[model samples]
Target: MLRITATATISLTVGAILATAGFLWADRAFPPPLPARLEASTEVLDRDGLLLRAFATPQGRWRLRTDLASVDPKLIEMLITYEDKRFRQHRGVDAFAILRAGWQLVSNGRIVSGGSTVSMQLARLMEPRDARSLGAKFRQIFRALQLERRLTKDEILTRYLTLAPYGGNLEGVRAAALAYFGKEPKRLSVSETALLVALPQLPERRRPDRNVEGARAARDRVLNRMVSAGLLSEREAARAAAEAIPERRLALPAYAPHLAETALRNAPSATAHRLTISRPVQSGLEAVALNAATRLGPKLSVAMVMADARTGEILGSVGSADFFSTGRAGWIDMTRIVRSPGSTLKPFIYGLAMEQGLVAQETLVEDRPSDFSGYRPRNFDMRYQGDVSVRQALQMSLNVPAITLLDAVGPARLAARFRRAGVMPQLPPGESPGLAIGLGGVGLSLRDLVQLYTGLADGGRAHLLRDGTELIEPSTASTDVLEPQAAWQIADILSGVKPPHGATQRGIAYKTGTSYGYRDAWSIGFDGRHVLGVWVGRADGGAVAGLAGYVAAAPILFEAFARSGLALQPMRRPPAGAIRARRADLPVTLARFAPGADGLTAAPNAPSEPPPQIIFPPAGAHIDLAEGTAAPLAMKLQGGRAPFRWLANGKAIAGLHRTRTATWQPDGAGYSTLTVVDAAGRAASVSIFVE
Candidate 1:
């Protein structure tokens, strides 16, 4: 009985001791590894499921994974050499190497070289951030062992290769290859492979172009290790060592980084989807912008953006390189940042008014001067253009006339116009009067402005804008913004402006804007296919007062549009309204202008064909009906070969001024005929068939 009892106590004590050791092992090992998040809802596409951009998501981060076969072998070889020598031969953990590592720890006193295997390194890389504890480590060890038992050696290596970061902002060999060499992983050469292979250890430092010497040394070490391990023969290492290394040209690292970063931010699942950004377009645009900025002089910081006009998805954007695009992360993303729109907004304002039924394309309004809520805006040149057609004022970019139209259309209504175009333009926060509308005090992103202008290019229809093709859907949701007549009217006006045609940008009808003191210079135009917007001037928000719209913004717009294949066409003019007939009896440059009231302007001998006029506002709205008035009104007129005279209510108003009002008494009351004749003999007249 005594012998049996002693044996039972011994067994208990042995079990207890074993339990303690197990506890200690658990303590030493850590938690389960966390894999880097691979998918971003905003950036990933089904077509590009293997290439995801990262973002915070509920289902955990997913690393975009491509076929292991697609990865460059040099990259695989690099990770294998740096991480584990006997990766193919080991189980989840290499016991012999573990012993050696234990000995090294005993002698050297810290966890340093040659401890973890490739599987271990990959384990650390993939481990969840929250699960990085000793107990979790042990748990992960078991999981990895399970992985080893279930999966082939090649599968483990493949996962490790796909999940590794190569350099810079690139998280995978595929991204790194394109980021560095602007090519695909399958196309990488030996020297290129070596450079890429050496990058995983320290992506920033090992960039061959930036630190070629360090990269070469790191690569040589990798090759020597491979040789020592008999993975490759001496002849192979010799040839690799002798290969020519290309000198790295330091392309600006921050080149449109803000653009991409903003895109990723706006695209929620971008990080997870491993967003397949068009590196070529990004790189090419940077180059194009750089040349433009340099030629235009550094005093100008240019922003050029190209988007998928059909869907409003910004394919690529180039903000100012002077700050973000040239170097590293900064405080601002200028592309998305807002600025005043200046004259570039006129087409939309008029286009919307025309579309909304607030005004017709043939609607005649004085372009001379506008008096509204204590504001009278002058043209850019500070001159009154007098009696001009809606088309004439737009083509001339007459500031006063645009303000008049805005007053008539109502600022609140204009704000609504911006929203309908897929642009939440920053208007005056609260409802005020007309103070901010015509002055351009409202802030708007270049992105928003680009989207807003799309309505014009799309011929009165609007679509929900997207960031990429993935976000687009087949929809009949398109709504009309303007009558085809009104849309064409504004488009023609923008295209017909003087010498440098300050308005038209791309081969498509375009418009230019100059903010106060030339703080911003802009050119936006479209051809048959593309819409392009170019912004130039100071990023510092300093005055570009002396700078003209033609200087940089317009030229760059033209150049980029040409390069991108937006062909210019003979623009279709606005709807017919006032007509001027070239009569043999009048001055050679003189012609007759006649209003199309009840089809009068179309009559023969009226001289020139009816001049384009506001037919219908693109948007589907109309203002309250106003009875025809015979009140004689004084006016100034523009758009003929020269300036013209005015007769209102069937009476001349050339020198008529009385009280706060200057009146032109035409022949009768209610609505009467008004007419104007220019020095060059072009005449413009409208009939008010009174109620």
Candidate 2:
């Protein structure tokens, strides 16, 4: 009998050893697949990892990417304590939990509590079944055991946090936090963390948006469980439980919508895209554009782009006034669309002329009417200031003076210079470059305009704007758009221009441009560190009345600069070669600009004699004048030149002629005089009073 018993014991021990070895081999060979929930929605983030935009996943759900480190520590502690107390001790499945579950089922004649560990719950979420049956539970247990052999504790938790559904279309803790609290998971308060940790157990039944009372109850249950498990103090748990439940879901951050689309195009396969944009700056500029658009009336769109001048990093871009307003064609990204640039190119023409020694800031240039190959360019106001200093002519945006320079600088050469600056303006089809290009003849985009201005800020060197993704580092190859002296001279001239109404002096060099027929208006400006451009107009190329750049766009530009929260750094000082002397102090050839008979390059010499001078209404002459019964006064001139600028008091007298005499009509009885400035910078003024 003893021998027989020994034999049976040996057989039983051998069978047990074989069974154990088989199980170990199976665990090593066929571990559970880490849930195949890899399809995540594309997320666009700002420079600091702040969410800028998010898209729905292929399955029409918001399953944002999440990890253990990105969640609040308090939330993770509560989650593990309430869901799986032995999560750290067990490999995956807890035998004690399964036994307790079975005992409860047997005692109640039905399933009462799920005694499922977090890992098992994760497995069920990975391979979700329609019905909660015994078969599904068994499968979850098997998958959990397999997962234990393949992943670490942290890895399992991350999978659960990422895949767990949190009601409706929202999945994952990050998505839940953003939807319920309008904040990131990492910034959750104690109450917020408890609510987030409680959602996945019964998402639909406890969804705060759908059932506030149910959500509160579930959150309280979590708090009570945490207290019982010693994970939280009773007082703290009660306080958290008392916190109000969120009753509504919030939309995610949606700034830089167009930029987000661009990012997706740049990296279509990426699950998350990071851009070089500042959240605060972008948000502020969006508001600026929207408010400006509303005030500018219907069908008017506003676009802006701001960048780091030195590094060429695009900081913010507002594609349109409102992304959803069809009335303004807001769907179109105005920053990228080409439109006539008006007088924006005049500054570059002046810069080129300065670089070539063709003109100096104070050098006198004729602003009178002139014809260049039948071009006959006229000023915006249809009146001339005669011979004005280059500085005044540029500040006033005199078209005749700009065309004269462009005629001398050759449109082809200007186009080449623009190419060197890393942008190519679009000339009208079937047309060669011409003087018209200097004044709104060519098409350019807001981005291109901003880039050129940034080049000026960088001392004439043009750099490619950085996209913030770092997928492609900025190139070292830079183009010299202008000489340092020329850039400084242009910046100096523009900086002195008067700011638009309601704007403070910001020490910024800026220029405004109005396209033909009021189709496009632009304001491009820069200080030492940043460059910004603003464009306002209709997207369909239709003209909008009263769309002058100085009045419409400059105000928006100044407001944007103020809202950006960036320091107003002063522009670079004049370089060594820059000239700072008066017209008379300059070299004889550079002192005065007298266009040649051909109406192109500077003449060989200034006129031999001074320009004609007015000699009428001798000093302090008072003549009887009335508003309705005022006789036209005859103004006489002495030797100088014709087509002179005759100002009655401080207003211009219309029409240009070589006649030695001119007529003026007084508006009312007041102190007034006739002041004439000839084409040679020679001026004579007489004081008179109308009684």
Q: Over the stretch 1-691, how does candidate 1's per-residue lDDT look in tens digits?
A: 9999999999999999998687557545643443343342233432233332333235432233455688766656655665776788887887777788778878999755555676665665566447445686555556566557556788777666666666544555655565567555777766567766777766677776678787788778777777787766888888887875544532323334554455555554444333323444455656666787777665667777766555655544676744533332223555566888787777766765443333333345566655565776877888886666566778778887677667655676777766665567675567553645566667887777777666666665555544443344435365445444446657656666543645343345677788877787777876544567777766677785566665557777766665543335444333322122122322211122222332122233344533322122111222223356544334333343323344432223444222222244333223233454434333454433322
Highest lDDT: give the candidate number.
2
Query: For model 2, what is the alpha-carbon lDDT of residue 274?
Result: 85
Query: Model 1's lDDT to the true fold?
Result: 0.57
TM-score of each: 0.57, 0.82
Residues 514-566 of candidate 2: C-alpha lDDT, one tens digit per residue? 99999999999999889999999998989988899999999999999999988
What stretches of model 2 exceed 4 Å from their correct place? 1-31, 35-37, 104-112, 466-476, 577-579, 597-691
Q: Would you list the C-alpha lDDT of every candidate in the order shown?
A: 0.57, 0.82
Model 2 earns a TM-score of 0.82
